[model samples]
Target: MSLHVTNTLSGEREPFEPHDPDSVLLYYCGLTVYDPAHLGHARAWVHVDVMHRWLEHLGYDVRHVENFTDVNEKIVAEIGEKGDSEASIAREMIGATLQDMRSLNLKRAEVYPRVSEHVPEIIDLIERLIDRGYAYESEGSVYFDVTAFEEYGKLSNQRLDEIESQGDPDERSEKRHPADFALWKAGEAHPEEGESGGQTWESPWSEGRPGWHVECSAMSMTHLDESIDVHVGGQDLVFPHHENEIAQSEAATGEEFAKYWLHVRLLETGGEKMSSSLGNYFYVEDVVDAVGTDVVRMFLLSTAYNSRQAYGEDALEEATERWERLERAYERATAAIDGPDAATKVEDAELRETIEDAREAFVEGMNDDFNTREALAALLSIATAINRHLDAREAFDYRGLRRAVETLEELGGDVLGFSFGRADDADGRVELAGDLVDLLLEVREREREAGNYDRADALRDDLEALGVTVEDDAEGTSYRL
Candidate 1:
């Protein structure tokens, strides 16, 4: 069966067809570098990583470009908190973001274009829009004329008239219409006059920064092509962000922006979508440390990317048990290859058929809209068969066991991005993750002894929310995760 993906543009589950049959151009709208990546960000990252892995597994040379919006007011807001200047703060947070990505064992994109570094490309794209009569400059700021693009709201499926104001409040008066988004927001004519306290580049409009929507368009077009195979992002960006991208990009190049638009749904906890605005986000680093990267991958990939996945202690514990089962089964299969029964060279037809079945199911699951949950189920079935064979140790087939081993590593590790051989740091770094709990308890203990009861209570409450229970005893504060 051919691979099928639910395209956001056509609102249909269509067959996978890259613009280039031999290669795939994938662009994921990455995080704005204001802080460390949260679970929401990690969810998108893992799914995109899986997509990359699956395409490469299918022999498609994937040129994936995931961008970082370093030129945002949010990065500037972190001046004193993260660094002294805009560049310094971006550098600090970008480093943390890259570290977080690495810790998750994500496949690095071909290029991670930063908005601050792509100013020239952004300006060139915006200039095209202006010259084509699709954008206008007002008060030194250039805005995309939403009305000019007849299909302005095509991506998001909202009429131009019904949409609310697009950019910053100061931009409302300068726009031809409230729905018109900024291609270039007017900034200080010089980098020194930063009331917004951000780095600026010299452009025809002003020494201003590129708007959020235009950054992706310029970066994608420059790195890949004006018309690409796939564009991936979070579900939340469907509205003004992606809609604006289609308008500005097509207006500039007069070509289709992206053929397939893939949006990953939100990760929720306590029935609330994990969001920064809602104050319900958990950092990717903290979670990875709590459970190893393998467990983290297992937890995220438990549900399909387009479906909502809940986050909680119960879910993670279940994923932990599942990973342990798969890992143990893998070890048993590997060890059996050179076991006491190795000389037997017995080929169990049943085991061989089971391996073939698992491979077929894995491929089918992957083809069916990248259904990782189903794919993982197929892998777990292999573990079950492997366990059954090893447990009934009366003349087991070493050849069959070898096939099972290869199947597990190939399907489980290669496509789904699981780490079956974690002997390196599974013992060291994962055990060290426990120290975080102890450190937090130490701080809470200080708060309690220092007579800051409210602060102590707040810490305990925070710990409880994170699935860690804090207990106070005659000895001291003890916690269980």
Candidate 2:
């Protein structure tokens, strides 16, 4: 099946076809780097990461870009409170955000253009809008003339009259229309009492910084094609942020800004919206540390990307258990291979058919608007079948089992970006440890066979002391750290 996505602009589920068929340009509206990232930010990026991985899996060269708004009102406020320079604060927070994303195993975007870095591009775009009569300069500030853009509300699906003003009331006084938003704000020593200061650049209109909306428009167009394959962000950005992006971008380029718009819904906690102001928000790092990276990611993906997800301790606990089940099934399937020639061995037709069907179902779910929740269900079904088969028979078709294992790894690890192995394995230490542990287990087996029970017990104790739990079962010795 060809991929389908829900386009916010068209309000329809349209077949996804990029301007260039061989490659896809994706731009996700990234975080404003004033503070540490929370779970909501994590969900939005992870959703985009899954889509980016899936696109690559389908043979498309994806050039993905996520922007950082390092120059913003919030950063200025933070600077006042912390007595740190805006550049220093932004650098620290951007680093922290990247760290959180990496912890969740999210692949970094090919380009992470910062608003401050792209000030020239933003100023140029705003100048084009002004020259084209779509924007006006007043008191050194420039605002997009909403009246000039006939389809100003097309993306957000609100009529011009029905939509109320979203800009600051004080800023609105300088705008031609109340709904018109800023392209650039005139530089000021102190816009607010607590604001240390905002970054400014010399522009035709004034010495000022790019507005929040204009920053994304400029950065995305600067790095990607004018008409990108996908533009993504949180659902809250559907209005104002994304709306202004479309208005400014299309106004400047006279072409479609993005072919598809994908917005992931907000995450909730304890039956209420998760908000930093409410003190109910969870940081991505804390969640990952508490429940493990795989569990946190799986929990987020278990919900449809476009639907609000209610998160809690119970949900995380359930995801943790589910992750364990998948890992156990993966281990069993891979471990069933008895010898070096296991790959050449044929499998039962029934097992192969089951795996093939599950693979199809998984692909189908993904193709239908990247339905990760449904795709995850398909994966769980595969795991369940593999577990049942392994329980029924100790020795099964090695090739079929291996095929099943590979499918799980491909879908879960490669596509979903979940790590099934030990976190410390990134540097190859896990493999070395496994080999050493296996050798010790073999020696312990030899000791047991030679009637040296005390030595075997001592070996087990030593392994336990190293945080490896060795269990003896019908399937011989198994160890986990």
> Which pairs of residues have clashing backbones in candidate 1?
none
Q: Please provide, for model 2 over 1-481, each residue's C-alpha lDDT reduced to its tens digit, 9 standing for 90 to 100.
A: 9999999889899999999889999999998887788998888888899999999999999999999989887788777564467788898778778778878888879989998898888888989998998999999999999999999999889999988887778887797778999888898536467656766788887787778899898888889877888999988899989999999999998999998998888899877777666778989888977887889888999997998798888888988988888888887777676554344555577777888898999899899999999888888887888877777764577878877888998998999987765565754875788999999999999999999999999999999778676889898999864
Alpha-carbon local distance difference test for all models: 0.86, 0.86
**Per-candidate TM-score against the hidden true structure:** 0.87, 0.86
Q: Which residue pairs collide in model 2, if any?
A: none
Which tens-of-lDDT digit does each residue in 1-481 have in candidate 1?
A: 8889999998999999998899999999998887778998999999999999999998999999999898887777666666777888787677778878888889989999999889999988888888999999998889889888899788888787789887779788898898888888776422234433788888887878788899999999989999999999999999978888888988888899999999999999889889877788999989988888999999999999999899999999999999999999998888878777654666677777888898999899999989999999988988999988878766778778888888888888888888887656666764675788888888888998899999989989998777565768798677655
Off by over 4 Å in 1: 188-196, 343-345, 425-481
Cα distance off (Å), candidate 1, residue 365: 0.7
Q: Would you give me the overall lDDT of model 1?
A: 0.86
